[model samples]
Target chain A: MIITKKSYTFEVSPQSVDFNCQITLSSLTDLLLTAAQYNAEENGFGLRKLNNNGLSWVLLRLALEIDYFPLQYETVYIETWIEGVGRASTTRNFCIRNKEMQIIGYAASTWAMIDHQTRRAQDLFTLDNIGDFASEETVPIDKPIKLSERRGVLTDVFSAKYSHIDINRHVNTMRYVEWISNGFSPEHYSRKSVKRFDVNFMSEILFGEEVKVYKTEEAGDTYLFEILHNDKPSCRARLIFRSEK
Target chain B: MIITKKSYTFEVSPQSVDFNCQITLSSLTDLLLTAAQYNAEENGFGLRKLNNNGLSWVLLRLALEIDYFPLQYETVYIETWIEGVGRASTTRNFCIRNKEMQIIGYAASTWAMIDHQTRRAQDLFTLDNIGDFASEETVPIDKPIKLSERRGVLTDVFSAKYSHIDINRHVNTMRYVEWISNGFSPEHYSRKSVKRFDVNFMSEILFGEEVKVYKTEEAGDTYLFEILHNDKPSCRARLIFRSEK
Candidate 1:
C-alpha cells in the first residue's frame, strides 16, 4: 500500500537563521515546500513527472501558524499530505514538529497545475488517479484566505534580478517572503516574532520586471503586504506577530 | 582517536538550483560552509564554543574549483579538514565528490577568529588544542589570493538590507556570491559554467550600507569583480568560466 502521509526531517543550518539565531520565515517555508516535493515525488505526481507533460504545480496560497521558531542546528520534522483534491486545485496540509516530536506548527497550502507553454491553470482532474491520494485531513487553523487589495505605503520598488528568479524563470516564492520580511526592522523582529503568515500568489513576475511592495499596518499586530507588477497585483500577504513579552 | 578529516553529504534541493536545474554558486558555497561548520563542531572548536568566549570564526578568503555543477536532487559529498594553523588564522580545504564518488570540486578557505565586541582578530593559537586537528592536506588549486584594485564597469548598486545580513549582523558570504553571480545574465550562465571562483573579504558590510558592484572581463573567459562600500573596497573576487560547448 502506498503511504499517503509522509514526514521529512531537516536540521536548521547556520545560513538559514537570522540575527536571533532562529530560522527565518523563508527557510521554514522552504522546508515545508521541500517536504511537499518529496511527498509528491513518492506519490508519483512529482515535478519531474509533471514537467514531462508540460505541466507543473504552482502554489496559489499558503497559511502557516507557528508556536515556536526552530533555532539554528535544531531539527524539525515536517509531515505533509494531501487534504483534498478539486477539479481546479488541490489542498495540502502540513504538521511541523520539534526534535522532541512535539507539534509546534501547522500549515495549509493550495496548489494548481499550470501549463508551461500557456501559463494557464490546467484541470486537476486530467491527472490520472490523483484524487486517490487525498487523505481528507485538515489542520486546525483556517485555510489560506483570499487577501483583499489595500492601498498601503510603498515600501520598496525594484526590478527583478537574476537572483530572484528560480529554475522556472519566475520570481521565487522565497524572494517574495524575503521582500516582505525586509520591510520590518531588525529591532521589530527582536521584540516580535511571527505568529501567523498568509500569502496568496495571483500572477507571475518575470525577470527584469519592475515590482513594487506596499505594506499597511492592520489592527492588533497584523500587517498586510501587496506586491505589484506594472500596476497589477502579483501577490498579497498578511503577517501577524506576537509580543515576546 | 579524534576524526580530523570529515565528510558530509548533501542533496541539492530544488530551492538551491538555478534556471538550469544545477546548483548555483551561492548554494554550493553554503554547502561548503555548512561542512566546515560540522567538521569544526565535531572537533570541539565549533561556533558555539567560540561564541561562549565572545569570539567567532570569520571567513577571510576562499577559492573553489569545480569540474561539474551538481544537478538538483544530486547528492554531493564534501570532505573537509584543517590544512594548517597559524598564529592569526587557519586554513581549511574541501573536496567535493559526486554520487559515483568521483571528485568534482575542491575548495580552500581561510578563516580568522575575531572578538565579537572589539571586532578585532585574535590569535588562533589561543584556541586550546586547535593545532592538533590540522591534517595538513591540501587541494591542487592555489590558495585564495588577495585581488588588486580594478577599474571595472559598474554592474549594480544597492543598499544592504535585512535579508542580506546574517546572525553576525554582517553581510553573508552567500550574498556576496549572489551579487557577483547576478552580474552575469541568464544567457551567460546557459553558455558558460563556473570553473574557478576566488574571493577575498577585506571588510565587513553591515545592514543599510550602500554598496556598488563592479565587473571586469579578463582574458580567456575570466572575470574580476569588486564590491565597494563608501568608495572603499570591501570585497574582491575572480571568476573563471568553462564554455558549455
Candidate 2:
C-alpha cells in the first residue's frame, strides 16, 4: 500500500519547553521538520536517498499558524503530506493536534531540490515519479508569502560559530528561528504568545560570517525580522503575537 | 519490584547533530538529563513532584567521558541511577551504550534541590526516603571537578537572550555547553573530537545579562573555558579532544 500522508507523535520534553512551560517555537519547528523527514523517507525520497545522488532538499519558505502551544510533557501529533509539486519547487502541509486529537495548528512549507556541488535548483519533474506523492491537499492558512525589505533597528550581531553550522555546512534553520525568538524579551513572551510565524530563506549563511539581526515592529502585534550577512539579506521572518488575556 | 535504576533509549534526530552528522554534545547532554528526569520521577523525587513543593533540581557539575559520538539516526541506550544523596546535593551516574550494546560513554552529574521562591539549596534528607534510591553505582571516569579560574583570550561576548533562558528563568545548561563548544572553529572540530567534557555552574545567568566567554589553550589537547557576567565568573568548563586519526 502506498502511503501519501503520515502522522508522527512527539512528547514535549522538559528541555524543549520555555519559561512559560510551553514548547518553544524552535522546538515545535523541529518536530514539524522531523515529521516531514519521516514521511519523505517512508515515501522513498528522503535526504539519505537524495544525498546519495549528489542532491538534497532545501527549505525556501515556511509559515505556521498555531492556536495553542502544547505544554511541557504534552504529546503532539503532527500529520504531514506533500501538497503539490512543481518544476521549480514542492509544497508540504502539516496539521498539528494535541493529545485529545484536537487540531491546534497548521503549517505549510516550500522546498527545492538542489545540486549539492553546483548549488543550483533541480527540476522536480526529473525525479522518478516524484509528483505521484503529492496529495493535492491544502491548509486553512495562506501560503507562505515573501516579505518586502524594510529597514529595522539592529537587534543582534554576531559571527557564525561552530555550533550554528549543520551537516550541510550552513547555518541550521532552527538557529535562525532561535535568533528571531530572542528578539523579544521574556516579559513580552509572558504577556503575548506567538500566533503566526512566517519565514523566508533567501541565501545561505556560511561559517565565520558575521550576522546582523534587525527587527521592526509592525502594527497590530506584528514584528518583522531580517538576518543579514555581509549586508545581504539571508533570511526574513514575521511573527504575530496575541495577548494571553 | 521497586526500580532503583532506569534505562532509556533515544534515537539521534537530524536536527540534534553537528556538521559531522554526529550527535552534538548539547543534545547528548539533553538525553542524559532526560534520563535523569525519568529515573527521578519513577523513584518519586522528580522535578514534577518537587515543583509541587516549591522546589526543583538544579544541575551543579557534570563530567562526560565519551569514546564515540553516535551518528544521526543511531540509537543509544542510557542507563542512569542515583549514586548517593547527601544533605545538600545528590550524585547521579550514567552509562551509554550503542546499538551493539557496547558501552560508548559514561557521565556523572551533581544536582541540588533548591526552593523555587528563595532560590536556596535545601536538605536532600528532608525528602522522605530519598536516600534509599541510591544504588551506589560508579563510573570509571573521574567525578566532575571544580574548575579553577583561568584567564584566557575573550572569544565571544553576548547577552543572555530569551531563547537561552529555561523554565527556571536562567540560562539553560545546554546553552552553556554550546557556548563552550563554539569556542573552537570548524577547522578545529574537523581535526579533533571531544574526548571528555567537564563543566561547573557557579552562578546563574539571567535574561539580558551580558556574558563574556574566554578560552585558554592548555597542554596536550586540553582547553579551559570560563564564562563571566559583570566581571564575575558564572561558569567554568574544560574540554579535552582527541585527533580523529
Tens-digit lDDT track of model 1 for A1-245: 24489899999999999888899999999999999999998888999899899898999999999998999999999999999999889999999999999999999999999999899999998988889988887999999999999859999888888788887789889999999999897788889999999999999998888899999998999999999988889999999999982
**TM of chain B, each:** 0.98, 0.97
User: For model 2, what is the error of residue B91's alpha carbon versus the real structure, in angstroms, after optimal superposition?
Assistant: 0.4
For each prediction, how big is the interface RMSD?
Answer: 0.8, 0.7
TM-score of chain A of each: 0.98, 0.98
- RMSD values, in order shown: 1.3, 1.2
Residue A120 CA displacement from its true place in model 1, Å = 0.8
lDDT of 2 by residue, A65-143 (tens): 9998999889999999999999999999999999999999999999999998888899999888888888888999989
Per-model C-alpha lDDT, please? 0.92, 0.92
Off by over 4 Å in 2: A1-3, B1-3
lDDT per residue (tens digit) for residues B163-197 in model 1:
88887788999999999999887888889999999
